[model samples]
Target: MKTFKSASAFKPQRQTVVTIGTFDGVHLGHRKIINRLNQVAKTKDLDSVLLTFFPHPRMVLQQNQDLKLINTIDERIRFLSDTGLNYLVIEPFTIEFSRLKAEDYIKQYLVDQLNVAVVIVGYDHRFGRNRTANIEDLKAFAKTYHFEVEEISKQDIDDVAVSSTKIRKAITEGQIDLANTYLSKPFVLTGKVVKGRQLGKSLGYPTANLYIEENYKIIPKEGVYVVCAEIDSKPYFGMMNIGHNPTIAKDNRKSVETYFFDFEGNLYGKTLEIQLLKRIRDERKFDSLVALKAAMQKDKAFSINYIKTLQ
Candidate 1:
């Protein structure tokens, strides 16, 4: 798929069938919409385009700094690309952009910029200043612009809403398996491996500490989880702990650390995308370093057994 960083950068070569949304997770429900978009594009012999916004609307409009998202902007782009879309446009959301009247937005973005032949949106979708317009308004605009407007049914929209809510709840509660089931893929954490205190090394399990730069990225609940990652084009299974190292440090800062089984290499400064497979247990403060080490050993044994089952 070809990606344009902004709507202005996308000079469409042909009339396009478009769908617009944040498409946060690009989970099953989002995929359903994407599938329909692709089908309609194929049937009409038009280019498939997905127009999404970055810095989410709520984040910009309400200054919602605390709103966590399922996927970082980069991750969302990657996921959208896998859906067989012909074009992907990431529009930067700003107050100025939000102020465009409904008709102006449709004319500039959908008609002039994208040359849209059809627009696929949810039944409850709204646009214009203060989001005053709805699906009916879009159909009215389509008549003026000489294009088609398709509204996804209320049932589909509800399923998408429920899936999004449940997925977020599952991740926040450490229900990785359930979240994965809903997402149709493992929950992923992408970050750079940073230097840590080397406490895990002392315990015979040196770990690569992860540092995610996107503070808005949602983190799974505090626990040790079975995870897998591809390093240097090779797959490796591991266990990850997401919690404060209470036994070693009193600072109480949460950390994401992973120890890859049967793997040896320098990972500092390397970016890794770890996929959480299952939650093993909650994180806890042990009485002593000896107790922590013993607990880690058992965790390793259980992880290896779990990995074997997968094999």
Candidate 2:
């Protein structure tokens, strides 16, 4: 897939069939729309172009510093790369760009810049300053731009919207399976291993302290999760904890720690990308270290059995 940082930089040699959205998570709903876009482009003998924005519009419009996303920009690119798209335009969305008049947006960006032969959009997609233009307006503008406009199925449009909300809700509620069902893939979290108190080691389950740098990347609710990661190019099954070590210390800060079953290594400073498969239980305090260790052993046994079933 070809990637362009800005619309100005995207110079398509062939006429384009285009669609635009943030396309967060690249979940099942998004895949359907992308499949339609690719199909239209293939039948019409044009290149498929996905014009997605960075710094998602909501983060800009609402000034929502606390808003989180299911996928980071890099993760989005990685997801879209597998969809057989021809062009991926990463438009830099800013306040000034948002202020562009509806007509100018179509003329300058879609029509003149992209040489778009067709535009595939959602039934309720809105654009222009303060989202003044709707799907109808896009169809109306198509006549002047000499391009065809296709609306994604109403069911698909609703599914796309709902899936995003549902996935986030599921993750926040520690419903990994539900979220994965909608996403069509396991929920993933990536981080670097850092030094920790080594409390798990004392319990015979050495844990790697994960430090996630992306503040906007959504972290699932505090719980123990059945997960897998690649270490030394080999898949490793593990149980992860995302919470404060209440049994170890009353004032312990929250941590993402994973104990890989049957694995022994020094993972300090190594990056790990963990794919969460299921939530085992919520994090809680135990009466003593002995009690906590016993509970952890049970969790490990359950996680190991679950991993075996997948194999």
Candidate 3:
């Protein structure tokens, strides 16, 4: 998919079938709408364009600092690229932009700019200043704008039985299986490998520490998880611990550390994408290093066996 950071950069030669939204996680629900956009675009020989917003609306409108997101904007782009979308336009969400009237938004951005042949949106979708315009308003404008409007009913969306909220909840609750089912992909964390206390190496389970820069990225609950880390396009099986080292540290400072099986290298400063496969156990405080090591061995065996089953 061709990506444009600004809507001005997206100038489709052919008339476009478009859908607009934040598309937070690009979860199954979002994919349903994207699928319709692509299908309609293909059937009508029009371009498929997905106009999404960045610095999520809530982050701007509500000043929601506590808002945790399922995927970063970059991750959302990668996820949407696999859906056969022709164009992905990321509009910068700003106070001034949000003030556009309903008609202006439909006309300027959708009609005049995109030359939209058709617009696919949810029945309950709201747009324009203060989100005053509903799907009804969109349909009314479609008649004036000379574009067809395709409304995806609640049923069509609810059939997926997934929402970004539910996915975030599942991940926060350590329900990796459920979250993955909803996402149609594993919950992932991409981060740069950083130096740690080297405690894992002493335990004969040397680990690569991960430090995420995106503060809004939703982190899974504190636990040991079965995961796969991709580095330089290669996949490595691993188990990750997300919590304070209760046994090793006097202060309970949280950290994300993963021990990749049969792997040895200097990964410091390199980025790795870790995909959570399943949760093995909650983070627990062991009485001694020996107890922790013993438990780590068991977790490794379980993870390795699980990886075998997947293969």
The clash count for each model shown is 0, 0, 0
Best by lDDT: 1
Candidate 1 per-residue C-alpha lDDT over 1-311 given as tens digits, one digit per residue, 9 for 90 to 100: 99999999999888999999888889999999999999999999999999998889999999998899999998888888899999999999999999999999999999999999999999999999999999999999999889999999999999999999999999999999999999898889999999987878988999999999998999999989999999999999999999998889758788999999989999999999999998999998999998999888888899999989999
Candidate 2 C-alpha lDDT tens digits along 1-311: 98999999998898999999989889999999999999999999999999999888888888787888999888788889999999999989999999999999999999888999999998888999889999999989999779999988788888999999999999999999999999999989888999988878878889999998888899999999999999999999999999998888547688999999878879998988899998999999999888898898899899989988999
- Comparing 1 with 3 on TM-score, the higher-scoring candidate is 1
Q: Put the candidates in TM-score order, highest first.
A: 1, 3, 2
Using TM-score as the yardstick, the better of models 1 and 2 is 1
Q: Least lDDT summed over 10 consecutive residues: which range in candidate 1?
A: 245-254
**Which has the higher lDDT value, candidate number 1 or candidate number 3?**
1
RMSD, each candidate, Å? 0.8, 1.4, 1.3
Better of 2 and 3 by TM-score: 3
Task: Score candidate 2 by lDDT.
Answer: 0.91
Residue 178 in candidate 3, Cα distance off native in Å: 1.1
State how far residue 24 of model 2 sits from its true place (Å): 1.4
Cα deviation of 7, candidate 2, in Å: 1.8
- Which candidate comes out best when scored by TM-score? 1
The local distance difference test score of each candidate is: 0.93, 0.91, 0.89
